[model samples]
Target: MNKTTVPSAPYTRRPPSPPQLPYPIFLNQPRRAGSRAEFVLTPSYDNVDPGQLTAEDLAIITQNQPQLVAPNVSGDWRYEQRREAQRILEFLYIGPHAVIRDHDFLRREGITMIVVARDSRLANRSMASVDRAGGTLGVRCQYIDVEGPRDLIHGFPQTIRDINDHLLSVYRGQMQEMDKNDRLLRKSDPPVRGKVLVTCESGNELAPAIVAAYIMSVFGKDMQSALQFVGLQRFCACFDENTKRLLQSWQDILRARASVARARTPVPGRPVPEAKPKRRLDQLRDHNDDEMGLGECTMDRERFLGRDAFVPFVDITNDNAS
Candidate 1:
């Protein structure tokens, strides 16, 4: 009695029991496999383009499918491009930091910009030679000193804007022309001479992440697909688990933002229906014009009273009991 009997440890099975197969974890997944898969943006996000994809006709290539874009590209030229910088998108490339100095290769690809995503504090120091290299091409170079995961995530918006503005500079010029010449129409497609080269110290960790972010933003792809899209093209590019987690967080942020936008958009008939309650109230007041009236003014009668209106659920249990 003096020695309290310790509760026996819960009986443990040698092996954990397997879950029943009746219930599956996943449900209603979207189709991924196809030649020309279509993705629709939320109704609010697509004021201009219904969807988005980086096009080769504008200036594109597949990561694994090298022959997809320029079938006639000579192997010798391909080796030159692959030796230092590699093409990941129609207007985008990624490689090691040293590639910036390879001006001849840059000239060959017509690279208008070089985006350096540096991971070290020394990254803040400007590579002026690269700027001169870019100056010759008549464009400015971008150096983003994003060291850790947190800084990289925060820098996504500004980085994307810079890349997009540079890539579509010609399109913007064409739009300005259209604005100037209101009476007459012009050509359909403008020549896209602008191209980008993304680089990191090793061209493995951070650079790939940035390229993946660009793909995800422009193509509406998830984090995994975006990375895969890049990895196929740049085989040297590394995608560690931590980086995957980082991009998944970015994916979540984008999804939440899209949801908020869709939520804010008013339904097609909502505005017209909102006035229905007010109109109904006015009609009732007119019908009672000859009878005893509430003496409500025109403004009061015209006002819709549905703001913060709460209609409680009626309890049906008593009816069944009776």
Candidate 2:
């Protein structure tokens, strides 16, 4: 509940000028405006670009923005390449904040952005093909041709400008907030705030988006506040099919557990433990004969004669002979 925002990290280079407002987010309002839901298309689970959207996967895009529909066409490499470039531009300069939070250089200024024909998985082959075909890749585009980093990089350049623009807008606001620090002085009862949703292709979105949401939640028309803000829901892995399913399962489990926790009765006079008591995993491990889970008795031991059964045997014959 320490609501103070963490200080920005130190940098060696001179900071770039902040971006102009009425920026990217101002241009591309999400399909769901009330709560701000940004939908990005990543490739399917089996595809080399595990979290990228293919041309055939344009339905999700159109679903989010019906007025502007993209064809789900495949083949005709030339047309596909052009469409891909256009999609990249739309995502970079006009997509939602989630796009910015999940991307990297798109998060900074002056760095060159790249998008190659082959994601990391196909870098060598893609390059060789391009080399043989004698085609030009933009100076910005590099053939990654590998997985993970490569695919991410290819998709990443597609949205760098949006991230930079958003970052600049935020920094300028931060400076203003620091100058007039009036919002921090006042404290409201209970001190509860509403939730903001955070989504990314991976867990990367949680940190930055959470930070931004917290800042906005605190500043809420009062730029001077430094209260810690909490988001109600975080959707960090929406881009992948498997991750999407996992997120759904996690939601269900949380809801069920929360419902049970809320329904539980509090002990009238007993204090709840301040912190969870420490216990070692080794202590929880059962001996070979220990009853599993029920913890009633050892598996092979007699219950009634247990004490008598442990009695020591006497060597009476040896004593008599002596």
TM-score per candidate, chains pooled: 0.57, 0.22
Range of the 10 consecutive residues with the lowest summed lDDT in candidate 2: 221-230
The count of backbone overlaps in candidate 2 is 16
- Superposed by TM-score, candidate 1 places the C-alpha of residue 144 at a distance from the truth, in angstroms, of 0.7
Model 2 local distance difference test score:
0.29
Candidate 1 ranges beyond 4 A from true positions: 1-83, 174-189, 270-322
In order, candidate lDDTs are: 0.61, 0.29
RMSD of each: 14.7, 23.8
Q: Give the per-residue Cα lDDT of candidate 1 at 89.
A: 66
The TM-score between candidate 2 and the true structure equals 0.22
